[model samples]
Target: MMSDAYNNLAIEFCGIKSPNPFWLASAPPTDKAYNVIRAFEAGWGGVVWKTLGEDPPAVNVSSRYSAIYGKNREVIGFNNIELITDRSLEQNLREITAVKEAWPDRAIVVSLMLPCEEHYWADILPKVEATGADGIELNFGCPHGMPERGMGAAVGQVPDYVRMVTAWCKQHSKLPVIVKLTPNITDIRHPARAAHQGGADAVSLINTINSITSIDLDRMVALPTVGSSSTHGGYCGTAVKPIALNMVAEIARDPETRGLPISGIGGIGNWRDAAEFIVLGAGCVQVCTAAMLHGFRIVEEMKDGLSRWMDAQGYRTIEDFRGKAVPNTTDWKYLDMNYKVIAQINQQDCIGCGRCYVACEDTSHQAIARLVDEASGKRTYQVIQEECVGCNLCEITCPVQNCITMMPQQTGKPYMNWTQDPRNPRAEKVPTAA
Candidate 1:
């Protein structure tokens, strides 16, 4: 149960006010007007309408989806070869206008993609603007089919194309423009800088990573085979959350793109995931694969949980904690070398599971030992402090939470890191680690 006497989750993104910061990403979840309205009813604050293109919508293949599973057979990764919205451009525009009129308070940003030519982008900007939608997000992240046609990831992969198309959209449309970037590129900052230079109001990241989830060993075909053949697709879901987080942090911490409003999009499935993005500098968070898997009702849990969590943390609003974690996220060269910690086993809490012992002895450092209690003839495991590196593997392997913990060791030495160490040839050495 949550009390209303707490923080305000409302946020202003790109000059548009959303009741909360949760928006449905441009995917299956926001493909139609009915879906968008239903999501809003379910407590989502906004939605990026499914990506649209010029007339003659692209045709999608049958069996265009696949899944990657975990040990328990839970779907952790999702793959899709589906192209942009296949509905007629006019029909989508009509629905967008109706949905926007019905829910004027909610943010309705349309996601778009088209040919590389400025004329192609120039042509659709006014049509989208006429719908009175809040803004536009260029969908340059779809990895598969469309890229071959010089659109989607094709435009996204090249910084020049991203900048050019973004400029075209800004020039032609009066609406705020957001450039949704792809993760396939070697450096995400390149495209982000390009978008900012092109006059985008904000940027949303981590559209999707290029991937082939699986291959059918028996059939010798890729996953979601469309009549004995398949192509690479965009991967999403919990499996991609780590990648998404790092990319978001990279952009948030980069001096070149810092202060640019970011709408985080990736494997965000719950309040905690959304909080992580916000703390890492997302003005708002968008969800897709999770909605596709569980349905729109999940937004209720997200809203309630985020509001309650905010209350507990003493945060009065989203801005209080947004980008709070950015300073702590830095390069390896800046990490402390003098600080040290060692693993400790809590004998009382230990269930005598030797999982940690086996893990440390075999795969990691030989820090844990299996011992027998002479009096009771009980088997137990203990950590050898001298050899323990505080890698946290023992703690991770221990099934009982808090059974194995890392205790800090006071080195009584001034802080130093690899960047300033005397042993390094390039660095002008500071005091070496004692």
Candidate 2:
């Protein structure tokens, strides 16, 4: 449990307040009242209820999940072919109203999906508002089943459609509107900008990416194979964290969308992941795959860890550090051309595993040298600094912690970028920053 003295996790995102930053995303983990109640009991700050559509509801396929595993058989990536809530609208609304009434302090933002029509938005917005939920997240990012029906990613991929739909929802409902953006698009900024222009209060992202996890060789069909045929599903889990972070940074730093509230959702499994998103400008974060994999109790660790970290960092609130990393995130062309780092092996810590040597010699630059003792036949590895590109491959491949480290070289040259480098043909095109 987070101590009351340092309980700084509370956040108010686009007018929706949550006791903590962790919220269950609108996936299977938040499908119904039963699951949502358990999540709240487990200490989740909130939940975006599984996407609700018009009745008669959307039906999902059985055997809807497939996964890519790490060497230890851990689920590194997850795929799902499931669609929106299959339950009727009336039932979902009743339960939503009950749960919100029961736990008024917690956020209960409803995730909604409807056809690209003004009448549909106008009809359903009032019904959802009557539930007394905190807000509504437009389901524009489901990349799998819903797209085939001209919903989900189909509407999300088009900026015009996103703006129009968002405008319709805002016009129809008084509740705060959050447009969920799809990751399948070439540039995420376009849809995000459109959502902002259409009067969205915030945006949650990186809804599942399109993917096919694996194929059953014998059946010649994708895993989670159904009746001998299978289709691509949305990919998620820890493997997508890097991609998610990059996209979040893109939107956070974009001049047009700057200061737009973001609810980051992609491969967020722990406190560190959530903290990274927060520093990169996410006001709050949503979780799905992590809860599905480890159950709802994981929020306990997430909350505790984040609280402890914040205390150590002298941050009293999430806002203190939010968007701190956005300015540091920039294009590679702006990187210092003269800056350099080289690998240095700590002989005392080195176990002589030679993993670093083998990795650098074979795959990366041949920067590590293997030395053999004449009498004892003992082996030692040393870094050849001249050849080291400071790519950190050797440091990454080493099994022993702190065995290989990258040390920055004291290059006397002033900060210079590719734009000012004399070697570049277009060096004169842009003025160098003073």
Candidate 3:
């Protein structure tokens, strides 16, 4: 009952095949079988059930969510003080098994977070494996609530712990293990390398950041205030996309972890976000905040949009464009220093708003010139090519689209990097390109 146009969206990540690359993340959205079943009905390819722990599960606070809103009151970033599943382990396992059996075509990845003991992992792995779920994503990334108990980021922030627990899971279970990484660490590469060393099947990231969205000035406390106080919660949504992309790229290009499958997470709200993650080396992508904001039906847009894009790009399969951008993602030191670009103003499209002039003159390079016609009392703004650094600040601040553009200059100078520049104190002794 599926169209051939979307056939290319299918992907097999770490041996778990799905109808498409979109999966609901292990969050409140996938907390129950009912929610997950609805998501599947809405065309989501898979779901990583909400993170589970041993019975007598995590008791969450009443006011668990806080959000930072955009000008239009849309949630730019979401924060949650809620802990893992508060339901009994037995109940969660039963639902997972039933869901898997019912929707055999959809991928069901169970997310787990237990104590960092080998015996604990040894005890739980088989119980989850018996459910016939497609995979297990180790929840080592929760930044709040659990970390204080030495379970989430407390374990993920340490490389040895990541490797040891991952090893234990591999030893105890036949299912693929995906180590969900915490972005709270200093360098994301360490834990990714640790997962690889411990023989993980794949890795997913970046878990919510530790943050406080805002404070109630009236109460004089952080948001989602419980009584007189509030604690920092996990921060997610569109605000974290840039950070997620960089971390995904880091693991993708690292020699120690190259070729290791990645299930990208963080701020992936639309098909474009999913495509960006794939191009940077994620085999699949997970979504949470977007679903919470827009409901399960959002996946329909994601699926249709991604399929259309793939068709237009002539990419027959996800693998065709996966990691295609990794080679081009490089260090700034390797960038061409001789490349020159300047801002150009299209007077015809300019509304004479003078926003570009004010922005550049006040804060940036003062690269824009404002001219007034005395006879007509009309204002015009132009880019001073000599002063423009091609920072694009003017263009970004401009209200009218296409009014300002950054035009590259053919400087005739050969490609030169910072390492080869004479201005560098420790310049490499390499011949310049002719």
lDDT of 2 by residue, 90-175 (tens): 99999999999998878999999999989999999999999999999999999988898999999999999999999999999999
lDDT, candidate 1, 321-377, per-residue tens: 999999999999788888899999888999986999889999999998899989998
TM-score of each: 0.96, 0.97, 0.98
Q: Which stretches of candidate 3 lie over 4 Å from their true place?
A: 1-5, 432-434
> What does candidate 3's lDDT look like per residue over 136-253, in tens digits?
9999999998998999999999999999999999999999999999999999999999999999999999999999999988889999889899999999999999999999999999
Model 1 spans > 4 angstroms off: 1-7, 431-434
Total clashes for model 1: 0
Per-model lDDT: 0.90, 0.93, 0.94
Clashes of each: 0, 0, 0
Q: Give the Cα-based TM-score of candidate 2 against the true structure.
A: 0.97
TM-score of predicted structure 3? 0.98
Q: Higher TM-score: candidate 1 or 3? A: 3
Query: Model 2 — which ten-residue stretch has the worst lDDT?
Result: 1-10
The candidate maximizing TM-score is: 3
RMSD, each candidate, Å?
2.6, 1.8, 1.4
lDDT of 3 at 24: 94
